[model samples]
Target: MTQDRPIVIGAGLAGLMTALHLAPMPVLVLARAPLGEAAASAWAQGGVAAAVGPDDDPARHLQDTLAAGDGLCDAAIAARILGAAPDTIAALLRRGVAFDRAGDGRFALGLEAAHSRHRILHAAGDGTGAEIMRALIAAVRRTPSITVLEHTEARRLLVEDGRIRGVLVAGPHGAMTLPAGRVVLASGGIGGLFAHTTNPPQAWGQGLLLAARAGAALADLEFVQFHPTALATGTDPLPLISEAVRGEGALLIDETGSRFLADSPGAELGPRDVVARGIFRHLAAGHQVFLDARQALGDRFAKRFPAIAAACRDAGLDPATQPIPVTPAAHFHMGGVAVDAVGRSSVAGLWACGETASTGLHGANRLASNSLLEAATCACWVAGDVAATPAVRLRPLAEGRLPPLPDPAVVRPILWRHVGLLRDAEGLRAALRALLPLAAGGGPASDPATLGLMLAVAALRREESRGAHARSDFPTHGAGRARRLTLNLAEAMQAAAGLADPVVLRA
Candidate 1:
């Protein structure tokens, strides 16, 4: 479909904000499901983290962010993002977002894991993500310049002459090509690549795959962030008992009614990667793990964390009376299509924001609640950049040629078994061996799974442990100073093949 406009993939906060900033330009937003249905942005419980409180400052927020990133965070990017917080907050407020307020009408902020101060802004108790999305969606809906096509999945980027022209999308209607002056990818994270995740099933790293296949540079693919405490009710892929629950005094305990985190330094407030690994170790040792909130929050626990409470009740447990079972799950990817501070990807005419792009703000691990802030700030920056550039009509491409999409069932087990939280050389090599044939078979390749494999391949190449990518065999950090990596499918595949079959590991 030829149109004089821009096409944005995914209708989460980032996409919507990008469209809003590029207002008056006809824009089409492709959504795989209805707004608030498929997007993970609405699933966020903790509010956006910014230095909005009097006691907090942008420099302090930047320091906390870099500290949590585990020595890999870019100082300049962290500071730039931190400094943009006030304007981001202002823009959200202008869009009618109703942040929680104190008795004196100041914004009421809350704290989460790894923060040095109370700078997280909340809304409706625990519905901050949904609330922010609701407001943004409303603004998009009212803007005549924006058109949202629901139930539409962006199959691939339509790259012509080394620049993005538009995308091929599969919707309920059928596969169709939508041409635009520019393309923005905000297709969320790689959570769905695992057996368990807090993000929705749609967040399967499709954006990363699409960019990789289209020759876009990717960064930090090895650093997948696993949240420490997803509720373990035996639900398919597990449900998130938000970090806010712990922020409200819930305690993590092993099966023997023993508080495990309490004995660790920082207790429930430890960094997520540390806590997740601790819980995983405990489980491997044959001990069960649970989150105890009954003693601290009592009946208020239910009202405070309704989603968690409901999930517990559905699983036949009462959080007010007993501890809730928990586990670590693949939660976020700190690396994705590498982008500059202005959100422009390596490919000209293409931009990415949100979890889909690795802007280097979230280094080895993400600071809690900083995600929403990144989405808003980066989207705004992209919009401004897009607006400042002179518009050029995109030429039509040879139609009907679409890139392959990978099968989820085929890639899921490989990722879960080999590239999971506790990965070693043996498992990663096995995973690479298993995936090679699938990649070669030439079936519709999944963008997300391909991106996941690229990450695993990168992790395998490193041969040493660092931050979120811990390898038991190489238990120490490598000598190479931390630097970003970007690889194409062929380069990554070659690297994967060179690895010895199940690379032997030493204890």
Candidate 2:
């Protein structure tokens, strides 16, 4: 209710860090569920990436990140964020977040796919996100300047003359236009829009649509990375078998207990997109896919990967006894509301961070463990930006009503089939045709369908197999200048509406 304090939507790591970094200046964090429970940050298991290991440096980290991006990464952004990796780790440590340490009293780093060194800092073993979030939530509880309101959703961003004035929030009491001096959308990713994602059902890219409607440009909407090792138990959001298991020497095996990824360059430690495709293709060829950790981890698997061990146990298997059943499932979203280095959205008085903002850091694909690092660093950047902004009057926007929503049962499969892991010209167009109407009428299905529409349009335009956006039809990358796509709701929809058939990006 305070006018000067900034209003932040989503209480994930980024949102919480934003509020924490802006101490003395109060912040209100809105959440769809209690802090930590519903956040993707809480589900993260790979830990935060940093260049603090003796064998690694920030420049090497930057190089690995650029390689995983599949020719679309912004080198400057990668250099800056990777350069600050150790600082980010120190900042988290200062907040009393304990990371595992070697016997020498130095931080213990773990290895992951596509990285040159063991640079990932984990907590409580495989429960890195849970540990970090637990620490942050506790820190937030002790801070008088930060206030968290759970079970409230931001339905819309209040914009006037290209500036975000506030947001329309919906809760048990009912809808209200909340006035504020600044607004930051820390909302999570678009995985909820897919049928077989590892994300919570509520992370359906609402922030992207809210910002786009408020006139913020969206970037890289086509690049959705799929995790290669989700427990395929037919769960709504399939339980993830974290990539760290592979980094720990787990092998990808097909039927007959033979190695599947043996021919690939990186093998089991390849980029997520490559690993996912390997599993997808293995399944397509009438073979069962599995993660063989029995030999590598042996009995130590239970202690080293407690979370994943429990997940396997719940699925009627044990990593100690046999290979875990696995399949590629939709996971992190690498694109979102485009922002600058300071987390400023194109609209004034607005900022975005975490999975919701595409600040050219991830580019075409995210390197392992970089998500949490980016979330933390970007939150700090946003805090400094907010501290410099001039105060303004917090006038309430007009009364608003959220649109009726669609059941995940109806839209999830359609998204997973067309826009999920592998996309093609024909499938992408059909997806656009079906989603355009649902996207047209503003409401609950509106945001989900809009993201799907944008993804389809972007996939159809790229006409190349790169990173997470694999086009089976296009099969190969085109020879041209590599540039990121930026479009608002109007521009994206206009391009989709004009699509009578499959088309490539106009020369």
TM-score of each: 0.95, 0.97
lDDT per residue as tens, model 1, 406-455: 55667777887788778887788788777776666667544545665687
Q: List clashing residue pairs in candidate 1.
A: 205-448, 209-447, 404-445, 405-444, 405-445, 405-446, 406-445, 406-446
Model 1 RMSD vs true structure: 2.4
Candidate 2 lDDT score relative to the true structure: 0.86
Superposition-based RMSD of candidate 2 using all C-alpha atoms, in angstroms: 1.6
Best by lDDT: 2
Give the CA lDDT, 0 to 100, for residue 185 in model 1.
Answer: 90
- What's the lDDT for residue 101 in model 2? 84
What is the TM-score (0 to 1) of candidate 2? 0.97
Weakest ten-residue segment in model 2 by summed lDDT: 498-507
CA lDDT, candidate 2, residue 194: 88
